[model samples]
Target: MTTPTSCAYCQQRATQLCAGCRSVVYCSREHQKEHWKRGHKRECKCYEVTSNELLGRHLRATRDIRMGEQIMCEAPLVVGPKVAATPLCLGCHRNLLAPQKPAMTFYKCSSCSWPMCSKECEKSPFHLDECRLMAASNFQSKINYNPADPEGKESAYCVIMLLRCMQLKRSNPEAFARLAALEDHLKERIETPLYQVLRANLITFIKTVLGQRDWPELEILRIAAILDTNAFEVRQNGERRKVRAIFPGGAMIAHDCVPNLRHRFDDNMRIIFLAKRPIPKGAILSISYTQPLRSTVQRRVHLKQVKCFDCACERCSDPTELGTFAGAHLCGKCKVGKVISQNPLENAANWHCQLCNVKKSAREVLTQDARLQQEIESLDKTTPVHLEEFIQGHRIDLHDTNTHILQAKYALTQLYGTAPGYAMDELSEESLKRKVDLCEELLQISNLFDGGWSIFRGNLLIDLEEALVAQALRLQLASECESKLKRAEELLEEIKNIMKHEPEEMQQMLAERQQILNAAMAPFSVGVE
Candidate 1:
């Protein structure tokens, strides 16, 4: 009707739409076949799923992609409450806050007898599929909707996602096929404690209570395994609502400590993957499955425990952790040398001081690291007093770039401006300078590990931008004020770009930031009354 846009292969007039996906238009049969042969055959969308023994199923770029390019935008196949989640609306997925009056109880769905926010939410599309299935089971939810402890997690919430997945077999077989095709790692997960619980509870509920005996025990467990491995944690509704969703295409992307891809969920809850840097064709696409601020050992352990895979990514293999030495500690013997692992990929490898050659057993290093972590965790973080003390006490033992130190610094960056009694205007001259210095140092580390439109970098930029603006407002000299203002302006522009794909709520916050920064920078004013 609209002339079919341009050909995907040649940028020429085209009418033939790709029959497989109907996403791309072809100029001619010859070009279509040629393009398919070139790589399009594998890519129904932007990246192609490929398999390897090391990484299992992984995605690769079908064509060269520019930085910040949106590579994939996929609607979730299924969405529901997390495996262990606080009480939330079954329909809207919003947190169910405790009622103001002690006697009042949460509204339950008329059909399913499950908690919902409102009558409108009871009719929500997300609730309908499960409402019908759950209603038919003649089983009423006994969630013990206690108004006193509304935020407490319900074990029953876990059954909803599994039921939704099981329903897809009849409701949407095509989507069910995609879900089935996903790597479940069931063999590896079957012996786990969680699976045993599922075997006793979830399997029995589906077969005996719900009267779904056709679904095999192994098949039911496989679905749970697939969800555990592939589901992405989704936070929405201004982050008050927490849920998990399965994006089949998104799960195909591999994991790396220093990943090339950054993903965000849109208002529609569709997962969008963007290239954080320019990616050459044939390169594998990756995103970090763990926190960027965690040390290599911490990340690797988390990956192995939850994901059931040993990560041998470039950043993990290098003991220096891309030269940040995030996991390294100060040598007790040398005092000057940084203690580093001999082989980062192996868990049992001995750590040695570079300068002193003092060897420490893996267990010894791990025990020391864990103790330090507990020390940091135990600190009273409401004020900067304990964090500052921790940093000063560990200066000789833990460098600024050490993972624990970085974690504290990042927290400080958030606390300085917003924390009660430590607001920007209330900050002393020394504390203001400290905030600026902390931000500048962290920005450098962020560039190395999570650079190029990453959420980590964007958040750091936001902090730095605000700090710079505050500094500019306080400075006496016009030139210094102007320089700080200029840098703040540049940072705000980048933040806008990085957060372009974020939800409406985030955009609203950015808008507020823009207004505040603009007011501060108005008329190039520097002198105070």
Candidate 2:
């Protein structure tokens, strides 16, 4: 009366067995076949090992993993609050749907209608939580959630409360219950900080400058202002119209000098992480949590100043960490080699490359970077319509692989594909091809840095496939067109393998791709070649 084995596919306990592969058991033949077809055909055997637990875990490579293999799929554990902060679709967070007519705006939520494709999207699960909160407020509770602000900033108050909510959800239900109980009154203290110093200054400013009116938009600006003025360190890149103010949650993720993860956001405001490299089992996964090229001393100081934590990560401990004296060059005059401070925890001492007598303070470097960043920001606003000029200007200061340059390239990719006046459709064939070429170039860099089963890579593949298909359609050469069509098909298949769990969307994309391939190959069907 032994218990039956479990089905490998869904991990369900079953009495029935597979007829074809009697070695494996299943609840039904259909599941057995499905499992085999899904590439579980070879991993059906059971084995015994005599090694220690770590050896048993590490030594066994049950199957070979391809570079871009689909390892696992998981829905988000938690999504951000759906308050209207940005011009993104509430459902997917990709940019909002464009209006069909030139003059008319798209549909918005009846309640807040801040930014949405339609009322249908307003009911989406992603919008449910924030919408509920917003509804409870009678639409009066402005969470400082305007995502369309040119500064692309969020209210520190709102962000801090969100973080507090997340922490409470994990630690104390009673405390969470108390906060939830006060949900109605929560809007009143939207200007107050959880910390005392911030709270005192913020209240003073609210009384002095803003008066008593509950201007939600004004409140949001004030929060951003507090972050800009009082937050230990602020980094702003005006060219990008983006500011990265350190958040407690983002800070808690910790740091790794050679980080395995990179992150980006879509229009819907989702934080997506991609694997930069093959992370082996038992590896403590990490993200940089700061700019990668910053010297160890600079990174540590910035983290401690803003995050309120001392980082003793391996890279921070190394004297010549990140290989550039933390990007501080040697002082030729003194010839005494300067290094990142031995005590990174204490914000003592100006940067004096120990070897050279020359010294520069942390304030000096930060001030310079901030000033250059402002110049880049100013240039960014002017050049959105003139991309080539934008690229040329950014190239002068930021290296090709610098983060600023990569950010510029990403913008260029989007503009080339979708920017109305300066899009691929308006460009000549040569220019269109060049745009596609640049996208492909960046895609390669993205793969190198953010490749592991991530939404970023997946979306890039989709974009690349679309561009190739477009190129094939434009070309008159039957043979060249056929080759491009085949390449696109291969890329789509790779995408499917990586995104198989997303069957509904993947199936639709696959069918559309097949249709394009068939259309492209039709002219060559009756060819003599």
Candidate 3:
């Protein structure tokens, strides 16, 4: 990569190439501005794509990155449904509005039978290529609104994304090149059951049914694999809608269990990454590929299955799981000691108890853990009764910070203030104490695993502050209430900083919380003024 010596507009010794089109060289800032105004706006990408030994290809620092800095902002290269169970607009990816009468039907694309929100979306450039292909194939979609099991109505629109990626080869070859460049882990995925199903069904459809057999079978499969390896799942703060999109740059940043970065989406659906903690120059930038609350074992298994690697980060290698002990179980034989994995990184490692020297097979531990998780999933989270019952049942087997119990506690935090029988004011003193305890416990855990102004810690703080404020109102002592309120204020300030990169909805929530705190304090002040 030699630097260009001539300007793109006029032949002169170049000082800068057009950042958007690195191909175009400019000798002066004035020439750069002229080129940008003329046409470079069409291709002004913020980040450069590069390759390395560790990540294959990953986004890297061009300069020193500060704390709370915005690194990459990217729009979706291709967006479509994600394993949808019901009819949703192929354009907007929202659940199709069920008809008022049983005889009525969902809105459909005028060109293709696939669902669409309106005629405008039907005409949208994003949907047109696939729409034309499906319409030409005479493959009418049977997926429609099923009010009986609205969210469970299985759809055949899964192929739409694959088709969109295939269409890009014709529509934009450059983007197709980028998509093709992504690491697909095809060697690993080929043995998986999903690839087998695709081989039998998708291959026939793309080659025979759609009559596009000219495309190489491996290339088609490679595109599908690239999507699986690189795409992001995107949704708004409160929306039920979820769609898949690829941000080439965002896709390149590698994963760390305790990541330095956190990501959020704007209303337009662009992915934005912000530094959760101050990242030093030359340090690898990463984000968590798994949920923050998941135990090391669970995260490792998921990463192995999906990303095709075992995570051996600081959190995963530790037997105590960074002191959270989220994967630890009670030693059934010892009756007093706790059990943990002998090798946290290995799937087949034996479990051992510190006391009594009791040992258990990995199979035995995993099976029991699975059974407990299934039991927890069967319960209704909106009510605490079932969760509490499950907790009580597992009292002997699970420690307080065991993944299952911690999951129950997290669910309880959401249910306490908002559940029908347990609104904030209606909560008994004992229940309020429990909610406070859960939030505090998780906050400490967050410090260990999701530290330094991460969303996980910020959310826990929010829950804890609310619980403290509610408790303060019931306390007779003025000093106690004031002291608790002051802590809540401090937490609120931290929340503001943690959520600076968030969408407008979070800002609104913060404002509402501040008002709530202010109103709560008005009763305490009996000023002379």
Candidate 4:
């Protein structure tokens, strides 16, 4: 395509091109700013949308992207509560307060008879569209406010985001068009039990009670499926407040077991994607829709179930999981050999012992894995004792790099510094050493998978650096103190770079960490007299 000579803003003859995309021309700096604010900013990105047979729609860098470069930041097209969610204010998406007294009722929206925090919430733009629709239809919400079970999931919240999406048909047709253009995989989901529930209950309620009969059942179901396929889980105010929002631009970035990009939400709830590693021009920009620590079988199964595709990514194809053996088990037959899948992508493929060639059926392997996972899950993790015992007990069966062991080790890293009687100051010398060792080991595995400026590596660095600082303070010898403090400084510098894109609170924590490290090093700054 020939570059246009006309300005994107005023359609006047133009000499300047956008530095970011170079696709649009601007007459002047003022026109550039105005054009960007008008919406060119969303279009001006390092990555462009691309598609394939496997990923359907995905993103690729249009130009070389530096490590930690901000790729895209987009506001949600629609935001609402999750389908099955704990009681939260629909207006603000915060957890609702428990009913205080004998009345056992929540503060309801006076207009819609739906539960909200206050009259202020009733007038919120998020609530008004649905409030007017519900009130006009005389639809009273059946969301029971049980004082005893205030934190329990409320099924009534399921209709909220769907209603918001449906409302966009009339309220904002352009947005609805963009939403409708997204891949919903409706055919893949329509027969599932969840869709069956929607068909029986949700469909009837929306069409009959809410009087959306003009909307076809299939079209409404498509919207639900779209939300499932594309929505990003937004966790705010730490992990306490959780909701879901969909960004059309964000939804285009496809999934990989090991992703090149990591995302975080800003205060305005805009989703920002950053390059976790340097990307050559035309490399696919990706994010992990599943946890990195999960075994290949577990991750593949989850991706298929949730994202409607099998991941044949490089990590998934490797039986040794890029030499970490995260998905392999210690062979019961050989007692020394690791059991690995014949083909990591095939669900029904046999697993064989490396030493003896002894085979285990996929069912047997999955069953054993599930039992071990359940055992680990059921163990009390408040203290490190149970986790340590579990790791020790399974050492012969699970081995060092087994997924279960890695998970337990990761948990122990968090528990050692924060759990009761295991605080950084309270930890014994042995436990401090153990925490450092765990962080180092996890950091290596993180490098193999989610490497280079990744959040996982950054978090491990934080843990390792803090432990190093503690070890430095604990040592009486100046040489040991200097060595550990120097290492801590190195780790802190990397942590700052990796987490520079993090939220303000995390940035503040990083500043505090630097101050603490500085205070620790102050004594060492002066020469021995």
Best by lDDT: 4
What tens-digit string does per-residue lDDT give for candidate 2 at 356-402? 45666766645655665455466643324555665576544344544
Residue 474 alpha-carbon offset, candidate 1, angstroms:
1.3
TM-score of predicted model 1?
Answer: 0.89
Candidate 3, poorest ten consecutive residues by summed lDDT = 95-104
Where is model 1 poorest over a 10-residue stretch in terms of lDDT? 97-106
Global lDDT scores for all candidate models: 0.87, 0.49, 0.81, 0.89
Error of 1 at 415 (Å): 0.4
Instruction: Name the better of 1 and 2 by lDDT.
Output: 1
Ranked candidates (TM-score, high to low):
4, 1, 3, 2
**Candidate 2, run of 10 with poorest lDDT:** 232-241
- Candidate 1, residue 518: the lDDT equals 81
Q: What lDDT does model 4 reach?
A: 0.89
Quick one: how many clashes does candidate 3 have?
A: 1
Q: Kindly list the per-residue Cα lDDT of model 1 for residues 1-529, writing each as its tens digit.
A: 2335788889898989876445689989998998899888666665677898998888887667788888888899999999878778888788776344333467898987888888999999888988887788888887655656656778888999998899999989999999999988888889999999999988999899888999999999999999999999987767467799999988989999889999988777889899898888789999999989888998998998888889999989999999999999887887888999999999889999999969999999899889999999999889888899999999988988999999899889988988889999999888988998998999899888898889999998888888888889888998898888988889899999988888887789889989988887776754745
